[model samples]
Target: MTVVTLARPDDADALSAFAETAFRHTFGHIYDPADLASFLTGWNPPDRIRAQLADPDWTIALVRGDGGAILGFVKLGPIDFDLPAGQPSEDATELHQLYVDHEAKGSGVAAALMEWGIAWARTRAAILYLSVFTENPRAQAFYRRYGFVDVGRNPFRVGNHIDEDRIWRLDL
Candidate 1:
């Protein structure tokens, strides 16, 4: 069985590795190798993960398989991206990253992590926001099922490549 729990500083290395692998499996084909490598090191490095784990404002939940391998994870934190005018940016939270190992894709891991994310966000703010690649229909549909609607377009930078991402919002 898989279990979801709060991430600790000690889990940073494993989380960082899993995050890079999951991201590469999902989107590596779209970027040049150098860009992908740069993005991984800059964004998912162990030191960064450790820092976030130690920060009070950030929450990371990991789904661990029976043998303690990381199967998935989700990150929640204060909104860092621009929000549309009139939106409650000050009190809003963001679902920064939600990823599942490729082998766990059809095993309901994502849903479990998302459920945890939404519940966790409810305690922090009234609004929850996230971004999804515009070309990713599967992810878009999943967010829609959770009542997250597209509110605007945001540019997501992965190294030097900019992807047109749709900003999604859910009223918690």
Candidate 2:
């Protein structure tokens, strides 16, 4: 059995371990090694996550297994993106990352984290939004199934790879 809980700063190390393993296994084949390394380290290192847990504005939640391992996490917060040349700005609470360890994938960990994130944002009167790599079709499909509709695209480069970021939104 698995349990979902709002992550506290004490779970920082566990969060980093899960983030590294899950992300490495899932995206290692799709993204360049160095870029993927930078992404994981930049976002979920223990120290950084500890700081985020201390943040008053960010909502960070996690899913844990019966043994109390942090299986997955979702981080959401208010953000303003300055649009590129023909785009307009948006008021958004971005889902920075959602990841589940291989052991926890089929047990509904992802859904629980997402549900918590949506509720967390709703309480703050913020709309839910996220950006998924265009190449991650499975993730895109999953988001769509959860009532997230694609509203825009961001064309950008990550390291040596050219990628399109599909933006999806859900009403709070």
Candidate 3:
């Protein structure tokens, strides 16, 4: 059985490693090697994960498989992207990252993580925001099923590379 739980400080190292691998498995082929390395070093380093784990404003939920191996995770936190004028920043939360291991696809891990993230976001803000790579139709479709709609496009930076990402929002 798989279990979903809040990420603890002790899980940082494993989470960091798992996050990097999951990201690479899904999107590494699209980026230049240098860019991918730089992005992973900055974003998935163990210290960074530890810091996030300690931050009261950030919430990371983990899906652990039968042997306690991480199968997937989702991160929820304050918005980091620029919102359009008239969008209430204080009323919005961000789904910063939602990833499942390649081996766990179709095993319901992503849905479980998304459910946990949405419930967590609902308690903190009236709206939820996220960004999906324009090329990733599967992720876009999954988000759409949760009532998320594309509001605009945003530039997502990975090292020196910039990719267009679709900004999605869900009114809680």
Clashing pairs in 3: none
For candidate 3, the per-residue lDDT at 57 reads 85
Give the runs in model 1 whose Cα sits over 4 Å from its true position.
none
Give TM-scores for every candidate, taking all chains together and pairing residue i with residue i: 0.96, 0.85, 0.96
Q: Pairing residues by index, what is the TM-score of model 1?
A: 0.96
Clashing pairs in 2: none
Across residues 1-172, which tens digit of lDDT does each residue of candidate 1 receive?
A: 5567999999999999898898889999999988888888788789988988888889999898888899999999988888776677867899999999998887989999999999999998999999999989989999999999999988998889999998899998
lDDT of each prediction vs. the true structure?
Answer: 0.91, 0.75, 0.90
Model 1: residue 118 alpha-carbon error in angstroms:
0.6
Error of 3 at 130 (Å): 0.4
Ranking the candidates on lDDT from highest down gives 1, 3, 2
Root mean square deviation (Cα) for candidate 1: 1.1
Per-residue lDDT of model 2, residues 1-172, tens digit only: 4456788888888888887887678767878888776666675688988887888778678876667777788888755443344333344477878988887776788888877788787776546778888778878888988899878776645456667887777876
Question: lDDT, candidate 3, residue 145?
Answer: 97
